[model samples]
Target: LKPLGFEGGPELVCQSLAEGPFGIESQADVDSVAMPLRKLVEGDNSSAAFVIACYSDPGLQVCREGTDRPVFGIAECGVLTALARAETFGVIAIAQRSIPRHMRYLRQMGLTERLAGERPLNMSVAET
Candidate 1:
């Protein structure tokens, strides 16, 4: 961010939910954190933008709807960045099971056609 010419670098805000899963490996885990994430975004008043770092982008839409500030999803940003530099792009996922979910998300974004492929590292989020 500093290299991009912002006076001060981006701030990092990390939150943990009382009952959320240790790792968001499934859709159920993503669903479990959505409302909590949205609440976090809504409660924030200082940040100029919010970036959800999760690959599944849990609560991205809800957070955007709850706040006036810009909201970005890491997955969305990565994909868009790749698209800007190439004709197509591939995704490196944490697990094989996650590929299907990512594909669904790409389809939702109407970017499936631009996807070269997706491969998994067969690792857990914590391991990665």
Candidate 2:
């Protein structure tokens, strides 16, 4: 836009609010979190895409279901885009307490074999 000489409107970037309504007690906070995203998309109120940034890839599946607008989660998008652009790719996540869960996600996404190898960062999610 800057190069095109078009000025942009105000922007909003909220984070760490997946639990907006459901919180941890619901154990499904993504459900609540996805509402605002879906509304903006469905209502045609968003000027740009939405990005969810939890390692869990919260609300990812349903968000796609709920909106036609593009949706992305950091880790999920990285791996998927990599696979789309390459024959193989590796995941370099911190080899911490979260390894099992990440491996499970890869298996679900059918990208386990894409893993050439792993270089454990050896830092726990909390530690990081």
Candidate 3:
């Protein structure tokens, strides 16, 4: 990030959820963190933009709606980055179960045509 001209470097905020799952591997886990993530985005004033680090991009829409600042999801960023380099792209998912959800998201974004394929690592988020 510093090399990208962010002189001070980006601040990494990891907000803990009292009852949230250890990792966001499922849609249920994503749902559990949405509101909290929204609140974090709404409350932040120093950052120029918000980046959701999770591959699933929990609360990306809600966070964007709650703030005027740019909100970027890692998944979206990855796809766009891949597109910038090539006509089609592939995804490496953490688990097979995640493929369906990711496929659904790609369909919703109207980017399914750009996706060449997706393969799972068959491991937990922690393992990755």
Instruction: Please state the error at residue 91 of candidate 2 in Å.
Output: 2.3
lDDT of 1 by residue, 15-128 (tens): 577777887788888899999988888888898898888899989999999998999999999999999999999888887877888888999999999998777877545654
- Which regions in candidate 2 have their CA more than 4 angstroms from the true location? 1-12, 18-44, 84-86, 123-128
Report clash pairs, candidate 2.
none
Give the local distance difference test score of model 3.
Answer: 0.85
Write down the worst ten-residue block by lDDT for model 2. 18-27
Compose the digit string of candidate 3's lDDT tens values, residues 1-128: 43455657776555555666787788888898999988877887888898888888889999999998999999999998989999999898887888888998899889999898887877545654
Candidate structures ordered by TM-score, highest first:
1, 3, 2
Q: Rate the local accuracy (lDDT) of all candidates.
A: 0.86, 0.63, 0.85
Residue-wise C-alpha lDDT for candidate 2, range 1-128, written one tens digit per residue? 23434447546556455336533223255455666655554665554666766655666877778776677888788887888899888665543445666777788888888877544477444654
Instruction: State TM-scores per candidate.
Output: 0.84, 0.58, 0.81
Question: CA lDDT of 114 in candidate 3?
Answer: 88
How far residue 76's Cα lies from its native spot in candidate 2, in Å, is 2.3
Q: What is the lDDT of candidate 1?
A: 0.86
